[model samples]
Target: MASLLSLRARPAPRRHRWTAALGVTALALAGNGLLAAPAAYADATASQAVDFPTHCVPPPIAGIPPIDGTTSAEITVDKAAPKVGDTVTVTYTVTKPAAGNPVDLALPADIMTPTGKVALGGAQTGSVTVTGPKKNPPVPGKGTFPPFSMTGTFTVTAPGSITLSPGDYNIHTSYIMELDTPCTVTNPPAPVSQTIIASPQPGANERAIQLGTASGKPGERATVTGTKFTPLADVTVVGRAGAAETADKMTVKASSTGTFTAQLTVNDKATTGIVAYEGTAWNADKGAGPAAYTVIDDTPAPPNGQKLNAAVAAGTLSMTQAGDTVQLTSVDFGKGGAATGDLHGVTVKDFRGGPAGWSLTGKVTDFTGPGGAKIGAGKLSWTPSCTTKAGSPSTCAAGSAGVVGSAGATLASTPNGALTGGEFTAGAKVSLDVPAFTAPGAYAGVLTLTLT
Candidate 1:
């Protein structure tokens, strides 16, 4: 005769089911070895029980060990190791033996892993806190009861290591006794899952820093590499002209490295074409897929000259053999060039844009100097060549002065000595002398101001 059923009802047994039978001993698995259904069956039923209190009520009797009356929890989970989503917390303990009465702990909605589910108390129920038995007093028969604590919170979404394999899980709760009085149930047998893995520490696979061209001309330089690059920090590598965060910017930083290298010139006045090199694979996160590398130079530029500010206000560049009447200052052609100051004294201005063609003006002249020394009148306006060449050296074959046009001469003798001959009018200005041998130093030439 074998019987193990626990399913109380009235006075204090809203839910509790535990059935067990024993006597089969060898049915192996229905291959027919045990023939007629009993190899010494007196009464048997190994394991099969479920159904417990639907909601509230489960805390009384601490020690554990009660089948139907209620009180039998053996939940346990050390560290299943998580990764998929990762979140674990399970601790259980309920011994039994002190008195009896004071048990109420419930947890078992299928535990997890069939389809996987967890969200019991949010923030993971704080981490752990489900205790029972701060006080139990109701002595009567079979002793022991006064300790019940449980804590379970899991999250691992798809990815094994929890316990070892096969879904892996553990956590079963039950214990109840207050209200009408019945308490006497127990559980804790099939549970001890496993499976959680992640152990990396292998070897090599990372070496970058190679940019061939991403716009060049100004200073013209672009060549950086990477082999064993031990550079800790300071490898900026930024080349941007437009698109992706605004700010026409350019940066290049590299303090040190192994296969060693660092060159990203092109600032000699770079305004050529497609410019974008954002290869910042610096600290290493594996970033530098496709952001920079679009540099093209048709190469072929030089030979530019143009200056115009024609008379009306007053202008004169006389040196008819006697000598002395030059105080222009500067005006080189093509490729940007212009330098002349002082307005309101007559005028003296000149400039020329380069890369292809440039021009600017202002010239109100009147000088004397050959010993006569006069120079008066003012009005000079033309000094725009802060110089942003946009990448120079556009080649230069045969003649090579490549693009030549000149006009520069200085020496108005203003501090008070003599030759006030840096002449001007509308306002008053100065600067003269040059053109004798043409090479002494100041006389580059390129002035064409026709402001009628």
Candidate 2:
């Protein structure tokens, strides 16, 4: 008969402190022949010595009672058919009998491709949840095991760049349950599997046309480049100038890489501002949309000159304390470059004893200092009011203001010769061309007026 090797758990016996002493006393008595042998040892001779095994023995295994529980799991995916770079969510609901001890649950998943297996991103180790006592009544057909439910979620992502062939692939979900009583049950509920039908991704549908320069004049050359058209297709690019289609069109065959480049000549009579171009591919679905280039007039018309003037009357001048000299305040051309006032306080004295003709001439010195800044003499201009009276004190007549002329030009006397002092008043205006690079400061100059 064969010997059976059975493994079981048993308790250890207690040892007393007098056990070794008692064993030594018994052996001494037997050696001294004061003790008699029992029936079980009757076969042994008197000189025979008893022996015991000295090797160490291993501990027995512990046994635990079987847990009365059952487990089931169901899995669902968010999207059945997903495109490349799309996210697919996997949701699992697992049911286990509620027990006082803790239990562990695991959900392992694998993504299948046509070639091999692919990895998912989130929660590979799964989750665990503890359930309290049941509240509601159990269903009629279901067993009396009050069920505890646990839900776990994980994600599977499809890659963007690679294209997968159209086919049905299976996503398998595995479940495992373990109890704290050193026992595990693995009735994984048929490995809840779902099928995903993967289809070949569609091609990109984007088109664009670009110009080397956005703005150009008539007769200038502009480079045009078109992208994302159909490969190896005949592309017709047309340039339209302001409300006129079919003005300029060029046809070129696209390369194997779906791109083309060409040069367009701006029409000689192209209207100024935004010209458009469009590209169409022959027998293909992709083409460039309308793109614009700015067409500007190269030669613009010149601007007309502007005339500025200011008026001064006889009341604008003031007489000096000596009474022999009459002075007129200078017309100030400040940062604004213009000023206007009436000429006041002019003393009309008998110079030649009789009514004599007088002439007024204005000469302007060069504006100096403040780092040698200067304005042209011709920029200073004046228009003088004339009177026909030959008396000592004559007032200027209405509508006697003359046309403005440059102060550097000689002021002609009244009646084209000389004035008999009807109080000649002049209106002055200055037109300056201040260069952008000039230094900033106050510039002083002299203006000498002589009346003879």
Candidate 3:
């Protein structure tokens, strides 16, 4: 116990040393804690370690101008697809304007992106100029202003949309505009857009017409038929041959099932050609269809390879006598009605040797045979009135007085009806007028005819 007490001298002030050691330990622990935690800076310094975002925005798109008149635009697609490989088209039309001064417009050049998505590809810049009206524009009829335009296409990539994907592309067209100037940022036209489908609707529902020929012989008839004819109206059969051109009075109507039939006759003595006989069918709204058939006067052969008579066959009868012109021969009348058949042979001869002045007219009836034929017939009378010919001769010798005359002829064989037998001879004739200036001479006229 005595020895332990003596050691105290060395322990004097040991507390101070211990306190210094404790202080050092505390500083080390604090330094270590600071190393484990990140440094916080209130102010940032410029350095390459930091990152900042940069962005770009396209300019506002232009709009279309206000059109003064009625106009329309339609959008269609060459191909539309969400499944890749689609094309789109938009059509802009301005109508009701005059033939020359039509409403001018613009079209979008940039359709879609290669990634299969729609975009306003305005990557590049260019302008379009059209020739039209200008500002301070003149009155409607005063005079036309110069033409002006400002429309163009741009390149773009896909835009973000729920329906669109990153790889899909579609043509995005803006409404075409009617601009006062190519660069005038003023009123732009409305935009039209369309998407091209991958597959187009089938053409199964389309209508069509097929024609065999356009022209034929006078006694010949043609048949016409077409799909989607029900909507057709005012179908007419026309024949255009040399100087003799005629149109049938009957108009064909289409059936309810979109089909139509028209029977046409080649009665006019027109030169046969590809354009000889024409069939025209109109819709209830007068919409016209393509010509049904072309006409061709193929030499007709009788049944069983028989040769048809080369002589002229008669179809109808007409009489006229004003001045200087007389019936050289009688007229032969064919069957009158809408029926398929050939006409008998008929002829007319001018009795007045030369030009003369006279007035004559007559009615039309059945035909009669020549001298030896045993066929009975009676003369046909007129309506008891005479008038100048419609659209008088455009070209006639000057200083010549016109002659007019009429003749009434009857068959001596058959009393009441048309000639039943082929014999067309021995008919009665009565003159309504004879030209006073006619050369004094014996005038004889004759008529003949057939029907198929």
Candidate 4:
């Protein structure tokens, strides 16, 4: 062997072989993945205007009734190009003021600036409540209300199109003592809907696994090793030979280290060609793998670098309830009175990426008490609410405040296309008016929830 100085003196290409190989490999990769396409709605500013009706009771002067008025809101998203993990600032400005309770007398300056919920749907679900600047101004019998603007910031956690809308709010005022006059958006002839698009971070690399085997003859069996898959998950390996397909479509469980080996049998009728094989593991616990194939007779090698695909199961529309039973807090009716309690939360899971919306309704049977005393279901009322799970495709809205005693009442619902596939929760505050003549006993009623 020559000395180090002598070895260096030998003539060499300015570019090393390893460096050149990497460059060629990178070029090949660029043609395969183009994930940075700009979003369609990447404008500098996105804003929406909505006109809706609200009903609120004016601070009680002993005989005042709830007032109805129209309110306009302008929803604005500050960032034009938002990405996952970015803090996005959103502002809700009252274009037209909502009417407060019309007091018979001048209301004192005891009302706190209002706080409202911002409803979100589409690629993202859930709402964020933000408080406006505190300013209490004395109002004559009838005055403009909710003129303050509120700004809330949320961290963008997922990439997709998310929609934002306005929801219920609470405004408080003092007549004798501080009391809250709640307001709800009864209807929106034209609801203000704004959408923002979030993009994936640059240079995001997903874990990849390779599957393969050397050239083989018709009806031959091959075993391929797979790595970098989910640890201890069940995996299915499928082999295909060009257009003439059907090879070893078999399942194998990964070791604790996430590595798996699958054996495939080449189809007896496989034509001679380069076959492609793909492996997938959709639910780990379920180990449910759907088979897709194209098989071959066999061809030359080194061997083609095959693709290992792991796809999510196209599941059905379903729900998994954690608490199937509920024991409401006991209420003491010292004197004949009404009892109020909250209903337990139920979950909604939709994986059917369809274009249709879904609704959840509750119909309660009449409550029966001791000695056969009966209470009508119409006496029970619920204020509905549906909370969206993070990363849900659409936002769910609360149902109207009504009793289930009718044909049936909506507990919570989502607009058409709201639940392409995601999860949310439905719950409500329930009030029961117990008759004074009923005897004291544990009353029971069946709350039937229907999903369509």
Report the C-alpha lDDT of model 1 over 1-452, residue by residue, as the tens digit: 10101110011122111111111110000000101110111121121222221111223334444334322234344433333222234334433321233343332232111111111221111112222222333333333344444333332223323331111111222323122223312232122222233121122223455556544444456664544444443334444332122222344433355343556554423232222222543222322212344434435555584433221111122111111122223422222222332222222211111112111122222211111122221212222221122232221111111111112112111121111122221221222222222111111111222111
Better of 3 and 4 by lDDT: 4
Q: On residues 1-452, what C-alpha lDDT tens digit does candidate 4 reach at each position? A: 00000000011232100000011000000011101111233323367678788876655644667767777887777774686534455567766666654555677674555656667666555564444554656776556654656555444445676667877766756456666766778873236457788887443322233335444555666655655556776566554332223444667777787676666666644322221122452222222221222334244444666544232333444543333222233333444445555655667776644334567775654543322344666877789988998887778888999786735688777775422557888777776666655544334333445565
Estimate TM-scores for all models.
0.21, 0.27, 0.21, 0.39
TM-score of 1: 0.21
Please state the error at residue 227 of candidate 4 in Å.
18
lDDT of 3 by residue, 1-452 (tens): 00000000001121100000011000000000110000111221111111111111111232333223221222222223311111112112121111111223323333111101111212111111101111222223212222211111111111111111011111122234322211111123223133221222222223444446644555667665656533644445443232233463245666667666666665544423211112453221222223323334465776778653332222221221112111212111231111111111111221211111111211121211111111111221212211222332211111112211112221121111111112121112222122222222111111111111
Error of 2 at 123 (Å): 19
Error of 1 at 52 (Å): 30
Which segments of model 4 are wrong by more than 4 Å?
1-45, 59-62, 107-110, 174-176, 188-190, 207-452
Q: Which tens-of-lDDT digit does each residue in 271-324 have in candidate 2?
A: 222222224421112444334555656565557844342222111111111111
Question: In every candidate, how many clashes are there?
Answer: 111, 9, 94, 14
lDDT of 4 at 52: 84
How do all the candidates rank in terms of lDDT, highest first? 4, 2, 1, 3
